[model samples]
Target: MAAIQPPKAQYQQVAALLRERIHDGTYTADQPLPSEPQLSAELGVSRQTINRAMNLLRSEGLVRVRRGFGTFIRGVPQVTRDAKKRYAARNQGTGAGDVEIKALGLTPRTEYVEIGRVPAPAAVATVLSIETGAPVLVRRRHLFANDEPTQLADSYIPWDIAEGTELLNRNVGRGGSYTRLAELGHGPVRFTEEVTVRTATDDEASLLELDGGQPVIDITHIAWDAADRPVEVALHVMPGNLWRLRYDWDDPTADEYPTVDGEV
Candidate 1:
């Protein structure tokens, strides 16, 4: 005889039903979902059950809760960060973030958070091969897609490299920072990025418009010039549900393990 299956918990059932409704267009991106009380009444469940279901959806990033507004379905991610082409695109004058946003027919904007020389943070100093607390030019900005914030980017450059240059300005002009670095003979020819995922902090959740306890993607990027010296270090944070990271490269061991004729 076949084994019997256990019934789903009340919240799981509710969440599954709600998820189906969302997928079937009963809920949409342009409007908020019905209030919790209304959902409870319609589903003949307790308000607590409805609240639990909502929390599950929030964790999955299917919906977001606003302070004074009702929950709303989330749109698809607006950025695809491809490691292979990111540097190549930057060399052409725009960063991969802006290029991807524009490719999706969305507007991209950058709001400067800070632009000045300051003592480098401990981590940043280590990455830039500088003494702790050494002065460095820091450019911090918030990247937006349309009106929604997408990323917080903070870049650090050595004092000697950034001094007396437009890299210290609010607007670094057409090609952005990399072009300026090139002009200074420190153009980046290689890059390395370390990526991690973790729950968002209170400030990160607020800035990214994410529900509390939501996850986020953290990245630390280092750029090197032809001379093999680190030219810049940048830190990036983005909402986990609103970004996709892609990487592609040829296998380094391909030549060592060359395929023989009729190998199969």
Candidate 2:
């Protein structure tokens, strides 16, 4: 005899019904969902099955559970634009840091301004193609969204290019560093980014106010000029939960011309 199966997949069925109801506004945002036991009784399923279903929804960022109370329908998952999109945007306004938080209906602010020349890390020096321990101007900013710290960034630029300009000033002025660079005749024509996800360091965890074991997205930005000279190297650290990176590309390779890669 075949083992007994509960008609079909109970958890998925329950989750689908709940998702539809939520979509139709039968369960409103921030509104408490029915208790697992109540749902189990109503759906004619086991409490365990109901719980798994709720957990599935939670993983989708569509709902949150309040132990001993009940689950609640949450608003749409807040998402930050893909880093690539931000870099490619036309320079008509503020920086990506400013635009992102605002789009999410949160005000953006920068604080903890520590700007000066510092010895570049060996990895950074290699990417910048500068000698290790060479002095580079470092601008560190702690970015916040709605008063909550969300990103920590350290921008490294060649000392010659960054010195004697607003790049060293508290304000980058006008469009941003790109504008300044254009004025200096080394405006970026191409960009490259190395993206990674890693566990946060103790200090990073503290600064981002992250709970134990939360990961982070680390991005290394390298901007180059038309002649293939690297002009900027910036390191950005963003809290894992606060942002989602997206990339939409036409094709990996469809041309014989030199694309993003430095191949000819």
Candidate 3:
């Protein structure tokens, strides 16, 4: 028999009960939790205690409060972003992270997509070797994993390269933009990425449904063509709590040593 433990504090007891429900699937990711008054009446706790418990869960990254919108449980981080595999899949004609998420049996989708010509921002111009304020084709979208918003992705390409191409379409179809670039004879032969972590801006927090003060992973990626010309620049911003990045590469020094015995 389990030991008879001392009673938990009112707020902690409330939290424990809610956490149990969350884990047991009584409260799923798609639905919001009961209102404070509802929970208070059901659990026979003071509204103050319920609020305190919710706040605790929010701080733990296990729940999110959407102001007017009710609170919702945040499930475990279910997406692993393996950089090498994503690029490799793209080369095989997969688009928009579909293959990666599908492999996990989760739905990957772009909830919002906008495409048009915009003057290049200074930073984007520098990366694409174009003049600031020059016309450039941009595609921006909000990506989702199942019903959960995952990331914001934006891609920029020089107007000369993007004009009249399907890259300007809201849906670039399978294999994504890279495959389209390849058809134009500018397929990316090399790529580079710069990654950083920082606090989310208000707009970012709203879009990704992140709690205030939550951090985000920002990635800047550039693709180069066979002529060594910069063909595309992309920015991907993701909620820091919901995803983990992965990188794998062969050891550089291994090539320097053929064998321990110095054989051919």
Best candidate (score: lDDT): 1
Best by TM-score: 1
Residue lDDT tens for model 3, 198-239: 999999999998878888999998999999999999999988
Clashes per candidate, residues 3 or more apart or on different chains: 0, 0, 0
Candidate order (TM-score): 1, 3, 2
In candidate 1, what are the lDDT values of residues 28-118, reduced to their tens digit?
A: 8888999999999999999999999999988777888878878988764546888777667865777755887877788888888999999
Put the candidates in lDDT order, highest first.
1, 3, 2
The TM-score measured for candidate 2 stands at: 0.69
- TM-score, every prediction: 0.88, 0.69, 0.77
> Which residue pairs in model 1 clash with each other?
none
- In candidate 3, residue 213 scores what lDDT? 85
TM-score head-to-head 2 vs 3, winner: 3
Q: C-alpha displacement of 228 in model 3, angstroms?
A: 1.9
Per-residue error at 5 for model 2, in Å? 10
Scored against the true structure, residue 92 in model 2 reaches a CA lDDT of 58
